[model samples]
Target: MKLLDPYSLVLMASMMCGVMSAVLFLVRRSFPADIQGLGHWCAALAVQVLATACYSFKGTLPDGFVLPVANLLFVLGNGLCAIGLQAFYGRAQGWRMLGGALGFALVGMVYWLFVVPSYTARVTWMALPLTVINGTQLWLVLRHGRRHFATYFLAMLVGVNALLVAVRGALALVMPAPTVDLTQPGALQGAYLVITAMVPILLSVGFIMVATKRLQFTLERRSASDPLTGALNRRGFDAAYTRELARLRRRPRTLALLAIDLDHFKAVNDAHGHGVGDKVLVRTASLVGAALRESDYLARFGGEEFIVLLPDTDIELAATVAQRIQAALRTACDSGIPVCTASIGIAAQTDPRQRLDDLLEEADQALYRAKANGRDRIELAEQEKRRASA
Candidate 1:
């Protein structure tokens, strides 16, 4: 087998990076602006393409121009990767720290390239900062990224890249090269160049995978949630019910459901238009959400009706929650656009065999009774009678 020359490998890396950068730039436009980081990553890949192009001209161009420029662009690319990861994870970008690090690394690279004139020193300077940047990216992925195959894949690639950079920096101290030219042919140099050529492609694949995972999650969330009120829709409620029922079955605990209906909701819509009605519904959902415990589940059943599932709660405790929601609605009415009150019906599952549909039917019946009895009061569903033994 014949080995490719270092110059050829460098040129290939530059071309590959340019293609990947363009691919990322196009892919980024498809994602929502709120989905941050793709822009930075795209820019990083473009900068890296330039960096490798400069390196490919090492023998042709003046060392003073090629060496410092290539190393600086390389470091800048890594720094941008770190920033992109931070943005993707919804963390502070810390631009000042990044600027300082890049400035410091550039000064060191210039000193080694011109003032001191040591190739090993320049390599060490470049590799060390890359190691730090890649390590930071690895940490962000592990700490903040979702536990998915895509997340772990990106993390693995980044972690290995960081390790390789650190090893290269360490090798510069232990095994100094005879020549200052990066294009010099040797086994280690070839291997390094090969890895440099391949990693950007691998990293881009990992990034796309992660972004795809994020898009999947976002779509799933939107499907399951009410866009107007930000509450779980009926589909989401059904899934939540299944999970809650399974959990309750394991623990042999009570599960309570509260069916809530906004009283005179149509009157509000008729009087103040849908825009104001939307504000009322959003405020009502917010208030109900605040009244419920963290473990409780809230879902928009349809129109002005919402449902709440409270695990490990009896009918009495569920009534207390209902009262709290009513109070919240009353307070909201006093302060906001339109006056609104919610009539709540409570039903509790004492038997593990009780199905979600049966519970929902009971709650709905009770809700009808609440509306019939007054309008803004709570009604408890009558417990089912056990069959008589023969």
Candidate 2:
């Protein structure tokens, strides 16, 4: 059987690469500026397109001009891929090492093209650097990326590409080809061209998927978080409450809630302005967060009010946490913020059937009493008569 035209495959690969590069460029324009790596990846694809385009003109153009430029761009494109992964994973891009590798590859390409004119030597020179770059990219994804499908998919694609490049380089040394021209047809050469053409398209798909997943995760986090103080918002608290209730059903345990209202918060706003009031809220949230255990959840219920959910804690322990928050805020006065204190109401539930509304209501009533009695104090909610009867 005859092989498909190698030059045609190279042309097809160049077109596919160009299309993918354009797609990534368009996608990147819509992405947040903080998300790094897409630009690098887009540039990498563009460079690869140019490399393959130059390579396709192997017979038509001067070998000295086309071969060196094509191979140089190929090496640069692979290096850019490694740099892109580094930026994606928030790691330092090793520019010096990449520069050294590019320089070495360029020197080898030049020597083989003009001085020696060996096909196998040129293939080895190009392939080795690409293998290193691809291997580095695979390692970065495995080490820094989240353990998920998108991470594994990208890793697998890069690992396969690296392996192929390495094996091709090894084969070039062991089994030298008859001709120096890339357009020469052979089964191995045809397979390599097809695989190379397909891999970039698949790789672009994988990149888009990974980036989309990150964007989705960021949106989810922002939805659940309070923009002002970075605490959980009411909706976020509700989700947390539901999860805790499910856990409580699995194993019976005490769950406690603390409703905290900032004392004289309005006075702070009136005297110092809303800017100071915002700072006080932020400081109060920080102090409360510092006081709580890892197992606890803190949320901004509304303006000047916060809620804390403590799992495996009784009313006494909840009261201790409330006092710790009060103490933390007491020290905040000296930290260049307006003096702030929180009136806290504590409620604990041993029954898994109790809804969050019931717990919140009891805590709110106790908070009302704490404010009525005197501000800046902790009050424990009286157990319901239904609980006493039970």
Candidate 3:
């Protein structure tokens, strides 16, 4: 009994799971939403603990209650973890598949316990469904989880447990010498006890790692964005612009920048209140963002100003996009706002060696000219005036 202390390890693992669940709850609140799938992960932990508790009373409890019920809970826990993995990847999962698997597990358990009389048969029956669930989880990680270290670690952990389960089932079904009981304290039984007790907590840890990794990524992205309009802030935009310049040097493509300023934005704030002004800002960003190509990048450049980077774009397309933004804002302002419009300044990189700051300064000059030209228009930076064009 002391040597085969599955109960102690199972209980300790359950306690660890409880601690992690509480930790995840706190960690989850810090993220944007329930993107971590912490709820399902925590529920899986609790379900696994409950399943183990049910199994701990194997002989003390009735076979019908202990065998089918405990196994069903175990399957449910695994299903939830699988769903959690899908959720973490921002993928949609078919709950019907899990429901069918769960139903099969229950039906198999009923048939094995009531119609069959052999312990070996019961072992193989439970093994098949459990292996299927584990294999499904492994497939998910292999398919969609290449970007993160957590995926690899989790796949390895689950793979080992799954192999152990398959081997255990094979041994129970085909071993020539029959054991007196599953708890007979032989090598096979000892290995089985250790695996069954240890795997739940280990799998829980893997779930926590993946969820935490994803949350970290989301937090990093939000940190680089304007919280109000979900546009890249000045710091984030600068980083991206620098990277694009490096790429442009190697690839030698025409990169265009559009510096946009909202016309009479201060008056909109003064007359209509800052709240409406904020709404206009959000609406402007949204409308202009929609008018650009997927490859084009938009970023908030502080106070009713924005920068759009159009990689591989010439001045013609850049001016067209600026005009589209102007038209979009014209209609938006006419309908929702009394008097709101935009003035855009365009600059194209003629020389690949042009610095980002210089490019921006030329665009700023054009922007200033647009403002000086009675606003609500577009101005192009004079390329001939620059020390080097573009």
Each model's lDDT: 0.85, 0.86, 0.79
* lDDT (10s digit) by residue, model 2, range 92-198: 99787689878988899888878888889888888877888888988898898887898899888999899888988888888857432346677777887789888
- Candidate 2 regions off by >4 Å? 111-118, 178-183, 290-295, 312-324, 333-336, 368-377, 384-390
Q: Give lDDT tens digits, candidate 3, residues 1-390.
A: 456554565677667766766766676676666575667777877787788789888889897899788888888887887787777776887478778878887887788778866677767777787788788778887887756788798898889878876776777788642552445656656666666666766777787777677767778778889988888898888888878888887887889999999999999999989888888888988999999998888999789999999998888888889999999988874355555798989998857678888998989999999999999989998882352354
Q: For candidate 2, list the clashing residue pairs, or say none.
A: none
Q: How many times do residue backbones clash in model 3? A: 2
TM-score per prediction, in order, is: 0.89, 0.85, 0.79
Ranking by TM-score: 1, 2, 3
List ranges where model 3 is wrong by over 4 Å.
1-34, 90-100, 118-146, 158-198, 330-340, 350-353, 384-390
Worst 10 residues of 2 by lDDT: 176-185
Question: What's the C-alpha lDDT at position 367 in model 2?
Answer: 91
Worst 10 residues of 3 by lDDT: 176-185
